[model samples]
Every structure is written in structure tokens, then in C-alpha cells.
Target: MSITYLEAIREAQAHALRDDPRVFIYGQDVGAFGGAFKATKNLQKEFPGRVLDSPISEDAMVGMAVGAAIEGMRPIIEMQFADFSIVGFNQIVNQAATLFWRTNVPCPITVRLPFGGTEGGGPFHSQSIEAIYAHYPGLVVLTPATVEDAYSMLLEAVAIDDPVIFCEHKFLYYHLKAEKLPSEALPIGKARIAREGRDLTVVAYSAMVHEALVAAEELSAEGWEIEVVDLRSVKPLDTDTVIASVARTGRLLCVGEAWPWGGVTAEVIARVASEGFGLLDVPPQRLNAKDTPVPYHPNLWMAHRPTARAVAAAARKILRR
Candidate 1:
């Protein structure tokens, strides 16, 4: 049985609500309209009052979730588009993420971001903003790639006691196909390997995981066996697994849709170079979007970001070097 990205997301929401009374969802068009991408489709009818349609205010939505978390309720707040999340930066970075540090009180909330490009969502709705929270001390960021992950990690995010930024690549939502998981998964700081090889290792998260896999396949066809590690948890990056993988392959290529300036790719490359340099055959390479704002035009947008071919090219060059 195959599932679409949007369908898997909705299934995860239902699983959370049914498994935990503390978990609930609230966001713009989340109730009757079923969200901008219909990820919350029919949830309002299924959960009734549990699924709420919030006002068109990201800040208020985040603050409300934070307040609820302080009172022992686990609330999952959805940003219709990841780009709109900037409006709630104060609530996220200052209030929600700092709650435990400030008063030793954990903020049990999840900020769900339906992020990434390929929808031609234009500049406003397309840019990946994981870098915005990359520097924040307490924010736990997680991105799910496959359908099993999409269905399970939401449960993990809801179970965590700290604030989480749950980013889902919108482009992968309906396009990807896979079997479903049983919907019981652990916390927000977990990573998994999607493919295994000994020649080179490609690390990525969210939609970039697919790109890495395609890149691996292409390289394999060319007699270059490449491994793909999905760094699902961006914040508490499993450097142990990444380092171990790099030790086996002796080469690494990190891929992400974030800007090249201060993206997740930069963080990954730095850690690999610093901690895993002894095991490397060549310098750690990274694949990221250009250091510019997302473009409105589709052709320019496609050219600006890293692709499967681009990742394969980078991986091959690193292997050769």
C-alpha cells in the first residue's frame, strides 16, 4: 500500500490525537478547510473540537501553544507555510525554546512546518528556514523524509518535552510513494540510514534525502557505490552515526535545500571536517541552495538549488579527489 506525503501526515495527526489526550492541533485552515496542503484533511471531522482553526497569526498561534505546554498540554502548532514562521520568531526563540533554560520548565510543543520548494510556491512560500533556528540553543529541529518517517516522527515530536521545529518538505508530500509505519516512534533527535555503501556517504534530511538516494543510485550505476544517511534530526545531529558512516566510506557529501551561507549543510560539513577528518580520504563536501533569496521563476528556482545530478556530481568529484 502506497501513501502520499499529505496522506501520511494526516495519518500521523490522527495517531497522535488517538494515542495521547494531551496532543492536539491548531492552525489556519486546519479545521474545516483541512490546511493549505490538506495535510489536516478530515481531521476536524474526526477529532471534532480537538482540531481548531486558528487566526491568521503565526505569533499568536505559537504563543498559544507555548502557554498550553506550560500548563501540561502538548499542542502541535502548524505554520501553513514555513516562510510565515518568521513572524513567530519571538515566541519560538525567546519564549518557547528558552522556557526550560529560564525556569527549568520544559515546553512540550511542536511547531509543524510544511516546508521546502518545488511547488513554485514562489519566493514567499518556498524557502527553507531551518537556518533561522539553527543557532537557537534550545530548539530541537526534525525533518522527516520517507512515508514511514512522515507517519511516525510526528508522534516523536509530540512526545518530546521541549519545543520542536518539525519541517516537512512540501514537494515530497504527494509525490513520494511508500508503505506506512505503525505510528509509534521515539523523540525528535533520531537519524536513520536509507542506503548503505562503502565508497562514499551522502548525508541529507527532508526532501534532500530523496535527492541523496537518487544521487547514490546514479553513482552506483557508474560503478561508484555511495551510501545515503538521512540526518532526520538536524539539531541534535547524530554525529556518531555520521562519523561512523564517513569512516567506512572515507568521503562525505551533505545535501540540503537551505541557503549556502548558514545552512544545515554548513553545520554538517563543519562537524565532519572537525570530528571525522582523520577518517576522510578527501575534504567533506556540501550541496546547498545558492546564497540568495529564493526566486519566483521556476527555471531559476530549479537552477539555484542542489539536485540529484548535482549531488552525484559532487560525490563523484569528492571520491575522485
Candidate 2:
């Protein structure tokens, strides 16, 4: 049977709870409600007291996790929606993120965010918040696009003695699947070449990775070999791998579901232009969601986020330059 991206996450948490005595899950409705997306489905029943429910306050949830981690416990905090994470902005960026650096005690906390857009989620429910968390130091921001990465990276996040922002795309929870969970995975902070090509490179992460691959396939039909890079971790971005890909392709088009202003796409283009400027034949281009709050209507939502069609169009435009 095929395992989905959401199932992979549940399995990873089960593994962590089974193996680590200090590991526990705490969040709003996670214990009994199985999380907003059922990412914690039946985990409370399986683990019993290990999974606990908290109040609706995101700030309080993260604060408690930080305290628990300080006392030698590994706490996983689940944010129902990515946008709601901003409610705990202070605790995440200041308290949890700076705890270890300031006190020399490892803060092992994992915050799972059900990120990205689904049709009709609107501005409040649908937002790509990875770039915001990635801006801070002492926080490991992960964007898992595939089932394997969703499983393995989460396990790794629990193992690391640092605050981690696990950004799992809500759209991929049921849409993407793998034949089976992986026994091993690429190390964190590494980028995977989803599709190899020589004409141009499309650097993307999370849900956008699949879009990039689809764009690559579409372009391939027209004799354009497009390379797609899946950035597993944004904070510890693998610039070397991205630079190497750009060197071979001689063109770059960064794609993301987040808004254009200072998002991951902008970061990728900036890095390629600064570190690998000599490797490009044309100026690096990027495609992102419109610079407005995510829309509620299905048609507007579809137009708001980057898609296979938009990515392919952007790639073609960059290629022609």
C-alpha cells in the first residue's frame, strides 16, 4: 500500500516516541482530535500520555515546548495552520531560537506547520511561512516536498538539539505518496535534483518542487532540458549544490508558493546571482504568489500561487533570454 506525505509524518512521530523516552507531542487538539489535518491521527491512542493537548494559544504552546526542552525533554509542537504560527512569533524567534545560544543548553523542539494552500483556505488558513522562520538564526527550517523527505526530515528534526520549523505542505498531505517509507534519506541541508537538465534550472522546495518537476516534463516535450532542485532545508540552504546546477544549466528560475517579497525564490535568485553570477547566460528569474493575502475563491486561489503552467511559462521566458 502507498503511504502518503501525512502518513509519513505520523509514522516518523511514532518512531520518535517509540525510540526516545524524552520525546512527546503537544499541541491544540493533537491528542484527541488528531490535529487539524489528522497528521496526529490515532497517535494519542497509540502513545497514550506521550501525546498531550494544549490551549489554543500558539505562543503558549511554543513557550511550554521550550521549557520542556530546557528540562531535557524533546517536545513537538503542532501549529494547525502556517499562518497561525505568527501568533507565537516572539517565542519562536526570541525564546526558543535563542535559548541554546544564550544559555548553552540545547533546545530540542520541533514545531510542525501544516503549510501551503489548498483551494478555499483563504488568507488566514493558507500561507507559506517558511521564509519568515528561516530568517532567524538557531532555527532549522525544513520544507519536505515528498513522502520520503517528510518522514526522514522529521525524524532528523527530533534528533537535532535545536529548534526546528517543520514546514509540511498541506496540499501534499494526501496528494503525494510513496510506495513505502524510506529506510534512509539524504542528510539535512542537502538539495536533491528532482529532474536533471542542461538548459535551465528551477530551484524550488515543498509543494513547488512537484510543480517544478511538472514544468520540467512539459518543457522536455519541447526539447528543453530543465533541471529542478528540491531544497530540503531553507535556513541551511545548500548553495553549493544550487550553484553547481546553475553552472551547468546557465539559466535559473526560482519558483515558490510564497509571496514574492523576500521569499525563498528571491533568496535563491539572490544567491545564484551573487555567488554564481559567472555561471549564468541570462538574468535569474523567479515566480511567486501575488503580493497579496491569499485569496479565498478557487479561481483566485489558483491564480495566486505558482503552478505547473506558471512555472513552465516562467522557465520558457527565462530560457528565451
Candidate 3:
């Protein structure tokens, strides 16, 4: 039997609750309703009162989690949608993020964000907000691309004595699967080379990692050896690994589902240029979702985000240059 990305996440939470008595899930409809995407499905029944639901207010939910964490509770807050997290931005960036640094009291809260675009999810439901949270100093931002990372990373996030933003891509929940849950995993803040090559390196995370893999395979047929790097975490970004990959490939192309302006892709390019400029044989390039609100139409939605086809085309352009 194959376990999907969503199941891996639920199972990880179950494992955390079983092992750590201080760990509990708190969010809107997370207890009885099992969360908006059913990420916490049947968790309330299994763990009982440990999985309690909160009011509709995102601000209140985060604030309560912060208070709970201050008192030694590891609370996992699930945002119904990535876009909705902005409602609790102040609580996240200022309060939870600064708690440990200001008072030397660790805030061990994990905020689960069901991020990225889906067909017809439109502007309200679809958004990649990793870059926003990653900007802060004290917060650890994670974007899990595969079923294994989805399982392992959550366990690690809950154990850390710091605030964590876990961005689990909605597009991969059901679509990506593995034979079984992983027994071990790469530590957080490490980047994994999904594919190895010499001609170019494609850096990506979340749903965009799959697209980069597809693009790499497509290029392989045309005699272009493309390397694909899966950036497991954004905030504690493994710049050393990224720079080494660029040194080997000598060409860089970053891809992301978020908009082009000031996003993770831009950060990756900036780091490569600043740290490993001499290693790059060609100018580094990147592809991202168009700078527009996610559209309601299926075709427009496809066009709005970076697709496998678009990634491959960008790689071809960079390889040729």
C-alpha cells in the first residue's frame, strides 16, 4: 500500500502526539472537523482533547498557541489556507518569533500552512507565503516536497524549541506517494539533490520540485544533463549545498510557484551570484508564477503558475545561453 503526502503528515502528527505529551494540535475545526483539508482527520478521536478546535479567528488561534507554547505546550496551529495566515501575521512575526530572543523563553509552536495553487482555488485560497515568513529571524520555515520529508520534517518541527512555519503544498497532498513512511530522513536546513548532472542545476521546493524533476527528465532526452535540487527548508536555507551544485553544473535556474518578485527563487539567484559567481559559466536564471492574482479559470490558473513545460523551456533558454 502506498502512503500519500497527506497521510504522511497525519501519521507524523500522530507519532508526535504519541511520543510527546506536551504536543497538541490547535486550530479552527482541527479537532472535530479534522481541519479544512482534513489534514487532522479523525485525529480528535484518536488523541481526544489533545486535538481541540479554536474559533474562526486566525489571530486568536495563533495568540493562544503562543501563550500555550510559553507555558511548555507544543501546539500545532493549522491555517485553513496559506492566504489566511496574513490575519495572524503580527502574532507570528512579532510575538511568537520574538518570544525566545526577547525573554529567553522558547516558543515551540508549529504553524501548518496548506500552501500553493490548486485548480480553481483562485486568489483567496492559493498562495505561497514561505518567503514572507522566512524574512523573520527567529522563525524556521519548511517546505516539504515529498512524502518522506512531509513525515519526517513535521516530527522535527514539533521537537524544536522555536516557532516553525510548515508549508505543505496542497498540490502534492494526494498526488505524491511513497511505498511506506520513512524510518530516517535528512536533517532540516539541508538541500537534497533529486537528480545529478553537470550541464545545469534547477533549484526548487514544494510542488515546484516535481515540475523541476519533470523538466530535468525532458531535457535529458535532448542531451542536456540537468541537476535538480530540492530545498527542504527555506529559512535555514542550505546555501552551501546550493553553491556547490552551481559550481558543478556551472549554470543555475531557480523555479518556484510563488510570484517572481522577492521570492525564494530570487533569493537563491542572489546567493549564487554573491557567493559563487566565479563558478557559474552562464548567467543564473529563474522562473516563477506570473505577477498576478491566481485566476478562477483552470487554463488561467495553469498559466499563472510555473508549469513543467514552462520550466523546461526556461532551462533550454539558459542552457543555450
Q: How would you encode candidate 2's per-residue C-alpha lDDT over 54-116 as one tens digit per residue?
A: 888999999999999989999999998989999999999999999889989989999999989
Those runs of model 2 whose alpha carbons end farther than 4 Å from true positions after fitting are: none
lDDT of each residue in 57-109, candidate 3, tens digit only: 89989999999998889999999898999999999999999999999999999
- Model 3 scores worst on lDDT over the 10 consecutive residues at 27-36
How do the predictions measure up, each by TM-score? 0.96, 0.99, 0.99
Q: After superposition, how far is residue 11 of candidate 3 from its true place, in Å?
A: 0.3
Best by lDDT: 3
Q: Report the error of model 2 at residue 165, Å.
A: 0.2
- Pairs with steric clashes in candidate 3: none
Comparing 1 and 2 by lDDT, which wins? 2
TM-score, prediction 3 = 0.99
Off by over 4 Å in 1: 183-187
